[model samples]
Target chain A: MILGRVGRALVVSELVERLRDRWVLIITALFVLLASGISLYGRSAADAQSTVTAPSIVTLSTFLVPLVALVLGHDAIVGERERNTLGLLLSLPVRRGEVLLAKYIGRALALCLAVGVGLGVAAMVLEPGHRAALLALIPPTLLLGAAFLSIGTAISALTRHRATAASLVVVLWFLLVFFYDLGILAALVATDGALSQDTVAWLVTLNPAGLYRTGMLVSLVGTEALSQMGLAVALPSTALKAALWAAWIIGPLLVGAAALHRRQAVTG
Target chain B: MKVQLCDIQVRFGHLLALGGVSLDLRAGAVTVLVGPNGAGKSTLMGVLLGLVRPDSGHVMVDGRPHQGLPRMEREKLGYLPEAVAFADNLSGRQVMRFFTRARGLSRSRADAVLSRVGLAQAAGRAVRGYSRGMRQRLGLGVAILSEPALLVLDEPTGGLDQQGLTLLWEILSEWREAGRTVLLSTHDLALIERRADHICVLHDGLVQAQGSPDQLRRDVGLPVQISVTIDDDAAVGALVAQLQRGGLADVQIATDIDGRHRHLVMETAPDDLLQVLRIVDGAPSSVRDLRVAEPGLDDVYERLLEVTR
Candidate 1:
């Protein structure tokens, strides 16, 4: 069957498996520590301190969620293939696309939980005005992690071995999370600031990480901060940015499904 | 349900994994596919499961042609691969529940299959703690969670102990009684020969032979062995002489490995078995017991492969 129905059982199992993993516990603990550490030292009587603590949480997740997401999803498909469960699973009513999509959703949910609980407890330390803002940081954090999870699943599909998937996902995480903005900065400097502000604004939205940064700045800090950051001219609207985030989450799953189908055809 | 894989041909580039194969699987029968490594048995199973799309021929299920078995039809099939793997972190019960949900079975069925497979005690244990045999039993449990009409198993007995084998036989017996179709591929021919209702032997990407056990033996025309116990060792000669006088001269004394226990053994064509028995019966007082060993399935399979080779 082509594009058959997704198996909810599979999605649930993937979620359960991820939740049971030791690495998930470790990531959650790391988030707890990071959120607590940032909130512990940044507390103040004034409500203006909310921006400082909440933005730090978002920034930390921006740095850490991709790593956790890639770690969670790197084995989603190749692990099943290596274990030889994929063939047996396909013998059921499930299709190849269904399995990949289910893994994506399942792992994404686990990451969402990690972001929720890991940073959620810190809301007790902050004042009422920004506690909601601190909570608001979670949705975008999950979106950013979900985009990486998509890329990780696709990497799992394209590679033959888990070792290869692990390495490839790390390389992708490094390039996208650690070096993407840096590369963009280098490109802007190479042009001697000759690049149009509109072009730079459009270019910044191409990366999911960059788009997340833009959305966070606009939502929390206002348009004045965005114009000061020099990406305010002709930046994408919030709806378009959400669509881009969704595209990041879904496009790679499609590519993973295609790769899965082609591999079965050639190898069977 | 009846499944017909007609004229199926699958090619991976220039190497033909399955070439012009047609197989008929009937209800209430255990049809076994036996072959050497790389004999296209797995490729054929893959086609049956819709994992491999045949380049040429189509599949017909219950007389309706299909590109392959449709997704809805696949729900009727229970497949067990050679390597049965599951999420190690999950408990055995959780794994079964997952499959139970995937098959759209009732919630209680997960425990029911665990009980049926003799895994009720270990249901709460993590699957990583399960032994190889337990894992195989779990795989079988998952395969049968839906009680599918057709079961396709690859190397079902790989890691099974004797008790596991007995449990499997019991399940297969139930399937037979229910008139479900079962197809399995294995290297253990001698163990499964008597249990299987029909045997299909594949060689070099083609079916060498397919038939009931008796039919294959008859087609191969292998000799039947007759063993007789005499009252005394001296009667061995008398029986031999009596058989010689009765025009059945080819007889030898069969001895155990230690050469202490002995019996008069003779070989005859299956058609001549009755006549040979009559001749041996002619010497009545000397004979204590008698038995006839029909040609074994492995022998017939060997002869068939020999001819093809």
Candidate 2:
């Protein structure tokens, strides 16, 4: 459905507020500097006769983009509620669903812009030959950012305190980004590496960050490397991976919106 | 438009925020809700705004039930919360623009409201630097931006000084003149007493009494107190004896601490006011000063609370 005038205005208002926040600016700058540093390192590796491609960008973003997205979105709802502005906003004609959707779209726009600028400039400066692979990496990286943003937005809606929401988002980030792969590895080792290839592929696809990483790697480095590393046995097609990423972005957002709708507006 | 609350009941956890309260807020009039702290005024406002759902009962605005009202219909209502908080980073003008835009209005409208609230000079300043009263003015500006048919204000006079209070009354009067409905919750009895067309006294989550100020006084049966001061002690004693002998059983007399002035506090019905004045004129003592005090909203409020307790 088309967002009405109120929804569009909410998005614009949220964008303006986010752009003015000092923390958002700092995090955007950090994304640019870090992406540039990674691109420069890849260039040095290329100078040493090693090939650098989209997998290099994916590895950096597997850690950096999710953090930036989380920081940008973790307080989207709870912060407004805690600060007493949500009451004023909800008192208007806008529905709770519109507010939540507008916030997600607004933050998503900022995340995409930051990631595009950071990676776009870096690709131009360091690896002009591999610019196409870098460009291919941007969409999956953005999907990854959107996925984490959805999770953070959900957590924000479930809590009333900003500190509590921030803490929960950090825990979620660690579990999905850092611990998921380690848990998979420990499971493989405990099974004496005898787990079926299909099982391993399904497990890898379950984590959004892992799905993003593998999707980027297969796109840029071909399926041959993934097969050799035993990470691509039953790997689905590119369309399937994109669909999964979309699910990750849209699913939690709907759940969060429902939760927000069920509750009363914050008041003093 | 008129707003009607029908047997509205709300409970938060174990605390009852509102009992089965019914009220009719008429159009083209200002309804002042007076109550003690924690008397469910805020919760009632929330119910009216559709922010807090009632456990039982519903509200009807202008003829349609609140839930049945379309988004455009709901947009015709405006609300000013007890504490006005905005994005501190945004300038006052930007805050207004944000709200105006959210309601599908233009920046020119925002500018108009800023000027209307007398905040045009400080429009460029960040809200973080605004005083409490200035923030309230900004809140007022936002509430009136759409020229809503129904305006709900919660303690709109909380941080206002005398001038701000006067300005607020002027705005309310203008809105009433425009044939819009204004529902406000306030504890400033002296300020709202003369201005409210209807007064609803709420206590302990119940509508203890609701009427026009005079109607409430009549319902409560509170008397008009007439205090007469006499400079001479002998005249004070003689007037007290004469009032007693005149068989004015409802009149109670007491001397001031100086024992020079006699206070004849009488519970006279409205019809007897003239007779009471004549009696005082015919008394044996020369009345140095006479003060007639009618039971106002404050007195009605206190009496209701005391009777209910």
Candidate 3:
């Protein structure tokens, strides 16, 4: 049979393996619970107030998305290679690129399920009346999750040791999710609240997750409130803005697939 | 032909892992690649399985080239690496499922393969708890799951104990009886001596010798050792000297046992036994036990190595 037909089976097997693993399952559940708790607390705090300036859904998603991405992706390829299963995968007629793509899709799907569970619970508890509003965020959140995993897959493929890959991913996550904001804050401080619009536009574009978070916030708050918070910095006309974000998401995936395609199963 | 490698050369940095290695495997036969460490056994297996690309030459499956063939081609090839690491987080069933999917087999079929590998009881147990031999057997089970046209294994008996080895040999023998090609690389001389049909001796990144076991023994020109018991060791040295001097034999003293009953064992060509007996007539009561040492693949391999060196 053609491998493409078997692709879903391979992916499902990976999903099952991930689900069966005690550490991964426990950690994933804990992460879901943490996201659920944060979502509930943030929504309650926002709703208890008489005003609805900023949605706590955006706050919770932006934090939880990267956390989930980092956790799910950091070990996918390197860990498999380290465990020596990568050679077994390569020995099969499956292309290296296909394995990478299948794994990324499989883990992203599992993470999406977790995100659904977490958000579903949070919505049931805090935003039962805003089900439609909460449901609107799922697609973009899934895209964000996929994008981060693609980057993580590429990083893992390039490193031989899992610990090194995890350490590097940790540093990368800190920079992209946390340190990049600090750098922007430093730049903002240096400019003495006189930051040029173009500089700020480029800064946000440099971090794909930041761009995704910004887009999610804009979608939730509407143009007027987003403009009030200066969060809608240079989001182009809607069509162009969507294309830019799409590029930000798929660019890493394309690069990752290319890298995976050229890699040989040489590690023993 | 089940698998064919033609003039393949795989180089790793400055090291040439396989230099112009070529061989063919036939169905229902055990083809053993025997060599010392770093003799390109693993590299050759990797090339055949399409896991490693050679710097030169091509691998053909059945009659067609293997490269660029879709994954379906690989589904017909089963491989067991020398050192196998399974998915630790997965249960044995889950791990088998991965290989089943890779081979495009049913999940139910996977359970059957796991059972065949003696992993039925541990099917639902995590692979992290499996012993090394269990993991190796699991790997073998995965390799043979599809009943592929060809099976490529690297040191399949590396970590197996006597019982595990015996069980694996039985499985391999059954596979052989079913008209499947089994191309295995091993340093276990005993296994090769007992099991291999077509033997290839690889030395220093080259094919040093290739033939069937009997044919290889002849080609290697190994000595025939004879253990003959004699009554006295006093005349053994002179007997050896007289045999050498009279152009009677190339006899070498292998052992000299001294006790209330003394015996001496001499190794020589099986054809020269009559001449040796004539030379030992000086000690008429010397003869007791006599047996001809059967030539083995190890002797063949050693002679081949000596000639190449």
Model 1 score (lDDT): 0.84
Candidate 1 displacement at residue B300 in angstroms: 3.2
Residue-level lDDT of model 1, residues A157-253, one tens digit each, is 9988899999998888888878987887898899898888888888888888778877888887888998998889878977888789879988998
CA lDDT of each prediction against the hidden true structure: 0.84, 0.81, 0.73
Q: Model 1: residues >4 Å from true position, as ranges?
A: A1-6, A44-48, A185-201, A220-230, A265-268, B226-291, B306-309
Q: Model 2, range B280-307, lDDT digits (tens) per residue?
A: 7876656788888888778778888899
Model 2 misses residue A166 by how many Å?
2.0
* Cα distance off (Å), candidate 3, residue B188: 2.4
Residue B228 lDDT, candidate 2, scale 0-100: 81
How would you order the candidates by TM-score, starting with the best? 2, 1, 3
In candidate 3, clashing pairs total 0
For every model shown, the clashing-pair count is: 0, 0, 0
lDDT per residue (tens digit) for residues B209-266 in model 1: 8988888888899988998887567767777877777665468887667655568888
How much is A200 displaced in model 3, in angstroms?
Answer: 1.3
Off by over 4 Å in 2: A45-56, A189-195, A266-268, B13-15, B66-69, B244-275, B284-286
